[model samples]
Target: MINLGEKKLILASQSPRRKELLKGLGFDFEVRSKDTSEDFPINLDPSEVAGFLSAKKAAAFAHEIVPNEIVLTSDTVVILEGKILGKPANEEEAFEMLFALSGKTHLVTTGITFLTLEKELTLSDTAKVFFKELSGQEIEYYISNFKPFDKAGGYGIQEWIGFVGVEKIEGSYFTVMGLPIHLVYDVLKNL
Candidate 1:
């Protein structure tokens, strides 16, 4: 367990995955987040957009942060070729995303930011996830059952699809899950 000497840890994210990951670290924190736009500049490199949004989320809590409170924010993005794939809006979009990702390798990037009343630190971790070629029936079944509308790239690494389809991963698995827990632990342990 990591201890933050007399500091109150505040997690400013709505992602249950992130919440669970943080809890696994054995740190006590409160979840506090406001709805914020996921929009990013079209010109941003897929590698950079996640970090941008992570810091943007942190800004929402800046005004209310106390001296001993450390706010954590994170954002995850899926990049295919060079474009960012956001969470799908519906089944059709979800199907398209999975189909495109079928039999291919893509980047899963997660940006994490630690903000205090005094300063801010933002960092990103990227992972390469390789999927087996998904058949139409497979995609349809997964979408109908899993309803990946809340996940980036229209899929979750901890779900059924990932269990059967993910053949390899090149980086931290926690990063693909939308929070890099090892990085989170290292950051807090050093703080």
Candidate 2:
């Protein structure tokens, strides 16, 4: 467990995966996020999307932050062939994303930001996830059951597809899941 002396932690995100990952760190925290647009500038490099969004999310708390409280915000994306793949809008889009990812390696990038009344820090982590060739039936089953419309890459790394199709991962698994827990721990420990 990591300790933050007299500091209260606030998570400014709605992602269940992020909440769960943060809980694994054994710290008490409160969730507080405002509705914010996820859109980004057209010129941002694919690699910078996550970090840019994360920091943008953190800005929502700019006026309300109090001393002794830290706000955490994060964003994640799936990049293949230099294109960013965000949450799919529907089953058809999800199927298309999954099919494109089939038998290929993609980068999963997550950006995390820590904001306090006095200071702020933002960082990004990337993981290479390689998938096995996914059959149409398998893709349909996973999408129909999981309905990953809210997940970047239209799939969850902890779900059924990952169980069978994820052949290799090159970085922190937690990053692919949405929050890089190790980095979070390290940041909080030193803060």
Candidate 3:
């Protein structure tokens, strides 16, 4: 367990998984998310996409942060063959994304940014997720039932697809889900 003394932690995200992960850490915090553009420079490297968006999200709160409050923002990206795979737009896109991910390994990167009135810290972690060869039926069933439009790579590792399709993960499980709890805990505990 960790204590923040007089400081209040604010999560600037709407992700249920992120909210749940932070709450599971036993920290009392408030969720205040404002919609921000996800677009970034097309020239940025795939690996830097999350970090850039995370920092952009944090900067969205620059005018609202108080001295005793810490705002945490995070973004996760799925990269395959050097291309970034974002959340799907619809069932067709979801199916396509999942189909493309089948029988391949992809990198899941989550970038976290902690902002206070005085200082800021931005960091990212990468996890390798190997998916077992998937069938069309598997892809259709998962997409139709789970409707993973909110998750990167059109999948959630904590969901049914993860149990049936994911072969193995090389990094923190929490990272693939959304936030890297270990890194988040370490940073928050030290703060």
Q: Which candidate is the best by lDDT?
A: 2
Candidate 3 clashing pairs? Answer: none
Positional deviation of residue 81's Cα in model 2 after best superposition, in angstroms = 0.4
The residue pairs that clash in candidate 1, if any, are none
lDDT of 2 by residue, 6-68 (tens): 999999988989999999899999998899899999899999999999999999999999989
Model 1 local distance difference test score:
0.94
Per-prediction TM-score, please?
0.98, 0.98, 0.98
lDDT of 3 by residue, 53-95 (tens): 9999999999989889999999999999999999999999998
As a TM-score, model 3 comes out at 0.98
Candidate 2: residue 22 Cα off by (Å): 0.7
- Please, what is the whole-model Cα lDDT of each candidate in the order they appear? 0.94, 0.95, 0.94
Candidate 2: deviation at residue 89, Å?
A: 0.6
Pairs in clash, predicted candidate 2: none
- State which candidate, 2 or 3, has the greater lDDT: 2
**Model 1, 1-191: lDDT tens per residue?**
66787999999987889999999888999999899899999988889999999999998888899999999999999999988999999999999999999999999999999999889999999999999999999999999999999999999999999998999999999999999998889888888
